[model samples]
Target: MKNIYSLFGLLFISQLTFSQATLEGSIVDENNQSVLATVYLPQIEKGAVSDVNGKYLVTQIPNGNYTVIISALGYETLSFKLSFLKNETIAKHIVLKERAVEMEEVIISTPFHKLQSENVMKVERITTEQLTKNGAVNLSQGISNMAGVSTVSTGNGIGKPVIRGLSSNRVLTYTQGVRLENQQFGDEHGLGISGNGIESVEVIKGPASLLYGSDAIGGVLYLNPEGFATDNETEVDGTGSYFSNTKGFNSSIGAKTSGEKVKFLVRGSRASFSDYETGDEYRVTNTRYNEYDIKTGIRFQDKRLKSTLRYNYNRSNIGIPEEIGAQNTSKELLLPFQEIDNHILSLDNTLFLNNSSLDIKTGYLFNDRREFEESADEAALRLKLNTFTYDVKYNLPELGHFTTIVGVQGMLQDNKNFGEEILIPNAKKVDFGVFATTHLHLKDWDFQGGLRLDTRKIKTEDARNPQDEDFIPSIDKDYNSFNVALGAKYNFSETFTGRLNLASGFRAPNLAELTSNGVHEGTNRYEIGNPDLNNEQSFQTDLAFEYRSEHFEAFANGFYNTINNYIFISPTGDVIEDNRVFNYVQNGAKLFGGEIGFHLHPHPLDWLHWESSYETVIGELKEGGNLPLIPANTLNNTIRLELNDGGFLKSPYSFITLENIFAQNNASEFETTTKGYNLLSLGFGATVKWNKIEFNWGVNATNITNESFINHLSRLKADEILNPGRSINFNLGFTL
Candidate 1:
């Protein structure tokens, strides 16, 4: 009898261990005809494709609540939430609507993964595929295409994002679910990231300190990495591109494979560019660059746990152009150049419980920056930065129509100098933050609010060089602040919606702003820091309205920001070492801006699209002077034609765009005004599938008129250097 009882117990345990949930679905169009589509679960990073009969199946799913998305080409995507029980099989059917615009995707930057249409806070999302289709030269230039967004450009290879009218340390960037830090306080420093292997980018146009820590007083840019392949699938792809003006080329190859429980992917990319030519056919000397990048990821999923590990390595050699001289088509770096290398590694894990879940993420990064001015082998300035970060969040069980999340985030960073010049002293920084956010849903309204408290401490070692002007005193300081955010979305009718948000953000003074006593080589200015600087705090109010219909969509967004202790640098009418002396100061400031846009696809002319947008911003100090580096007003218009059904060539498309930049008359004490300019661009592309392989090709021409002009925010504007003009690009790719 004892042996029989033991056998029964063993059988019961084996059954419990093997039990799992399954999800099966069917997809159809509005006409009730079967359609091929992709079904994805964002929570577990699992996906499936519908067959000819519109049937799809996903197995080994854990027993929990999940959001499922169904999407197809030239059709409106569908998203809904569902729950599953252990050892249960659920069946669901969905019907999609035909549309000309792109489908909405799941947002990862937010704590809760929700579709853009269902989110309370307004966010702008753009895919890597779209960026490529739009013919962007780099990641920084790509994001500038969006409304109310621009870039502060140094050359063809270096650019930094500017939201509204704020740049530098005011805006924060996040990649692989962690804050990206690479000494962003300097205007000449670029975003140390590559576009290869990245899936999409999401932009929060206002204060985001409640979600991210300090340095988010302006906004946040979140980059999401590409996902793994579906179960039991393997794929390989390669891409190549060529540019005319710069005589440049970019090449990359990647492969990914997935099993039932494990998945892996890797990619390698390289790019090189020569001196770029201006409208007058004169090459800008030393405006060349080269880059090498590698990305890889691995993932594992089981009944109750899902985990992913990702890594990226990037190296860049960029030149600094002073004047139009020594014209040559060479990709080699000249004097006064920058060499930077970055490494990033991250791990993310999610654990599902009976009615709740926990998410944990950790990241490590290392940055090496070197500048060579006098000698090719010797670096005049070198800075090394290392950072480690962690974030943990707990999702409480949902109650009726309410959902809540509580989280903790922190980071430890160290900066060191190895070269002869010391821009900022060796420093150790620590940060800690805690916050809670909740969402409430009703019949026609969605409400979201959160509160957070953050503390940062910085300690630096003194660097005294009596022989030179480099002397920074040792200092230890701690800063603390509390922030809050509240937003609401209301549906006025079936075709109209309104949203309003109020948020507060803060930023602690960086090492460069708190303790600097030397010449900044890039800006050619002597800077003096104030060790007694206080934290910068800001409050902003945003209002937005959106209208949607079958063939037309429109949106309007406006914001007003008030800042306290806004830090800026101004000349002290003194000169040191042939460089103007500047001192950091703080005062109250205000910024106001708005964006309006509309898209139209007439009923019968479904293949044609017309879009227009206008953006403007104004910044002024409360003491009565225009803030420095504010972007000028701009307008953009585009007309596109889509030929989805073409013999041999599939999904062919073409577009023409016109951009107008208005004059900037408001200038600071040491700034100059800029004149207005217009630019025209054209592009066309198509996809071809032969047997089991697919080929994609495109051609894009920018500044087709060869118009010579200068952007107000260009670092080279001081020298009256023109921007690159009249560049034709050709791209080709294949998938197997």
Candidate 2:
């Protein structure tokens, strides 16, 4: 402890005399009156708050071209770019316009960071605070509230994200600017991400291959990690939560500190849960799970170079819930469970040139997965995957109201099996892609377009000999494709906006689709692969409209997508070792969907808010058959009441919500129809100050009615299992 303090002391002393530039700015209302606001620089990870005089100052900033964002309550946000020189003190003033609600947030998933209202493509964002409100148990469930998004759930512990009728390898997930590559080809495999270190989630509902690469044929879910504190600031926070239904517990602690030229942060968290109960008061045995994770990062910046390094280690133990068993509530897992350990390391660097800048990112990932079933002495299956990836992007100098960016990305991966059963053969894969995009900003309209090309190669080792009963031959294949996207946003009127986008995406066949030849224990089926399968290509067109006013806000979004050579699994007439046999096949498919929502806050009672949203999707093959694992239509309604600051309560809020899911009678072969159900939920939250320290707390109750129902996407739906119900959750957090 003494040595640690000394090291910190030395680091703090080193930053006391740093040489850098400072940016100062003031904000004023339309009447030229002073307005207190927040001034933030995203790239520099520094910010300042304006005082009563409407003046804010951020010091120790590296010299470079930077975008500054100024935001205040009840006013429109302002964003602009300027250049700063070494040891220079620049001053600027900004005037704000009054708005009924807060301005839209800035989106970072795109090649060019811009406010959602200004971007040509529509993106959905959910913050950590919003996740907490939903009382979710995992990262996938945390995002299930968004429109056009759901989950293929096993129980309280396992869930895979489904976006616009797509799941598994079809959808892509990114964390800290690097693609997440776990063994996601299986139906029971969930996203191995902890919500503790994540600050927010951004979802692109349609194909984003022009920015991302192959596998993005469906969409992208981007997780933004928590950032460091501002300059010369230090903070520590602790949080705890409890759940009634599962007897679950979650705890975490984090600390961050930033100096003039150095910044660092660390966080540790743990969570555990027992078997979850159904609405009928019956427990789903062997559904228990536990997880532990640690994360740390450090960043340094000079006049022209900024660099950051981050690392995360995660370990999880999940039980495979099946038929009912004894009713005892034990957190320990029985046989037929999974153990996973994942490690991620990343480094990012940015160099500031005269006008244009270069950004470089590198990452390393290791995934160790083991499944134990029938006995506790040995693992039935074990797979180890290693991946190394890099990305480089160059931003050209702004010219004639246009911003351009060009980039290249690639990955190398190796997969090996060391267990009794091999679901997929040992393989080595390589991927490379290049893209260029440009954005044009006009007075009332914005236009953006991009093109990308990608190539992938796969080689598998021959694991079978002529003497073996089921010999699989060695395989080598190469896949390549080109994609493009074009989008436009127009301000139809002062209170209305419209956006249109057309995009194309492509996906190469995964290892499981090309090599699997045995039973998949997770899905309880024998699967066969096709070596001649072709790549899948998709084209989608999206249109959106938004209307905003002082009393109400409304939005409508629609999409139509078509895919060529869409791969799906069909049951074969033959049976293998008492298990049904399924083969991978391809066909043409189409999907259409739309979402509409409205928010109303009457003038006389602004504290009362009413919101309603509805989403639907239809997917079918060109040969006249329905697609499997399609989500049912859903509608959601919420009523909220907001309270002003009072004696000990600050910004107290309460809400009640109703969710209605429609029956899914349109099912594919080997699928059963699912009955719909309605759910009611309630929650409340408030912040209180004690001894000069503020504490935030909340309580949520889900499935208040205790109704039992099954979800169409539940893997256990075939077994007639019910979803979780009657869970009361409580959470508390405080800063030190």
Candidate 3:
């Protein structure tokens, strides 16, 4: 495309005739003024997410010297290392101080961290204050060791987060990067990802499709809330958790405060469990689980600007062990008057002047749901849904090193099933979109590109039967797609960096994949719908490499996929009396995958930590066939020993882990060949601060030596066993 506007018109005309040197900024919390949406630069290692008000703008070229890092989460991280002047653009604004429970160096000068490694991508982060234990469940058990990610369950109220071999909706969750569009259609919506109110969980593996959008094709997890905070200023703080693992027991609590301008937050948690045990005999009789949660939020900043507001409430009852009938039945998986409610509101702002800074954002979301199971005539159902969402964004500055991102998105819907007159007719649905992006800075090299446009509309309620009663014209449908992305990076020395990306993607056809007919029974199948369907194009590529130094680090990536239409679920009409009707098609597909990671700590001995990961995935069917549930070829590892940083032990630090997972046996196209297993896990932690009060205690061991495997996406089958058998998880908490 004019070579991406002639490489941003020659990197903004060589930053307007070489005179570069101006390091300015603004990222706030303690009443400084602006935090916009979110940001943290790290001398150009790249980090920006603020845009509801707290503004920013970074440029390039031999400007002498620099340092500026501002973080957000509960507030408390701002670095400064001044010196810049050459051809000019300098502005400054900073204020973030709320954490300090006794800094030991505060996790290394805080640049917003969670195990970093980038050149090709290796996010790996985990924070809920190190997983506020207390019966913690969901969000894949708080992303434990990361690396290629893994977590699958139909028990413990079900957990999902498998990457590499992919997971429903081709992975792509991001609660803070937006794009959780109910995960592109069912898997029981995986309990809507509720990790007892999360705060940190980023495992971005591969193909991020340019800042996330679409099904990510196969990567991007995000989910950041509560950035991170400790104490120092005017404040209130909290921590609570209690746990038991063998398949049960949990607790919850929360609180927060920071005043200079304004800041407040609250959290709540509750968990329950019963039924689980199976090493090949006895005790796998319909697992058990439960839940309850509530949350609140508020924020106001200074320096440039900042604002926030949040709310949440949840209720649960789970246990869906294959709805026994031949005599193994006793499940609920989600029922007790089954309920799930979500309401969200957001606003952000940031602006400076004299070089660049302007970012704003707004949001609103509401969802109401009630779900239960079994219906292929066995009868015993319940399904209801209502969703509404709106969003807006913009970022511009550094017209030279280029950083221009623009946005607009929307959604509206209403649904009902089993009410008879509402089976895929004018139930109402809408979607709209717009996008733009740019970012470049040369010398060592870095570049980016983007473009997007989307629109979709679906309705039903049969009026003339052009498929159903048209709330409009037999209820109509229309779709549009246009997307593009390009990337580059080069350094090759200093530690190594060389990456490349080429993308052209699009995904539109959600709303339950075009008018559903119900009887999903949560994967038991029988979900009929088509409505002509189309709009799923894709063409991706990636080749990467990264290497770092401190203790040790490494990353590698390789990918390729070519799809067109690619959406599946076919089998039209046959066996009406025995049961069979499936529909939801769009052929022409292909997929590929790759990933590898490693890290080794250098110091902290007697406080050891090491990590490992390996992954692979391959999907086909452009006439070759063999793509059903796909996910085989995986390996994960973790080893840690921290004993005591609370000195001599007793409460402050203690850790142990030896975990591994390998699942291979597809038997071709899922005729069931899952028989690969090895499991062992152990854990320990302690912390009980004095004066100001704080406490955290944890204990865990899942399948320690009780190995009874199966994970090709097990729904239920004990030909060799899978799930429920040998367990122990515990936690305790308090903070304020």
Task: Return the top candidate by TM-score.
Answer: 1
- Select the stronger candidate by lDDT from 1 and 3: 1
What ordering of candidates by TM-score runs from best to worst?
Answer: 1, 2, 3
lDDT of 2 by residue, 1-736 (tens): 2453354345333323234688887889999999989898776567798999899998767655677888887687888887776688999988998764645666878877777877899999988777887787778987988999999888877888888898888899998778999888887888888899898899998899999898888899999999888778898988888999999998889999998779999999999999989988999888899999999999997666679999989898999987899687799998889999989899988766645567788899999999998777788889999999888777777788788988788999999989987878899999989899999989899999999999999999876565775556779999999999999999998779999999999999999899888887757788888989999999999999999887789999999999999999888888988988999999999999989999997877777889899999899998889988889999999998877688999878899999999999999887899998999999999999888677999999999999999989988888888888899999999876
Which ranges of candidate 1 are over 4 A from the true structure?
1-19, 466-469
User: Per-residue CA lDDT of candidate 3, range 26-120, in tens?
Assistant: 66666666655344443223234555566666544233333355566434445544445565677766676543211111121111221132222
Clashes of 1: 0
Looking at model 2, the pairs that clash are: none
Clashes per candidate, residues 3 or more apart or on different chains:
0, 0, 61
For model 1, how does the per-residue alpha-carbon lDDT over 103-131 read when each residue is reduced to its tens digit?
78888887778888878888889997777
- Cα lDDT of model 3 overall? 0.55
Per-residue error for 362 in candidate 2, Å, reads 0.7
Give me the displacement of residue 70 in model 1, in angstroms: 2.1
Query: Would you list the C-alpha lDDT of every candidate in the order shown?
Result: 0.88, 0.86, 0.55
User: How accurate locally is residue 489 in candidate 2, as Cα lDDT from 0 to 100?
Assistant: 94
Which candidate's lDDT is highest? 1
State in Å the error of residue 508, model 1.
0.7
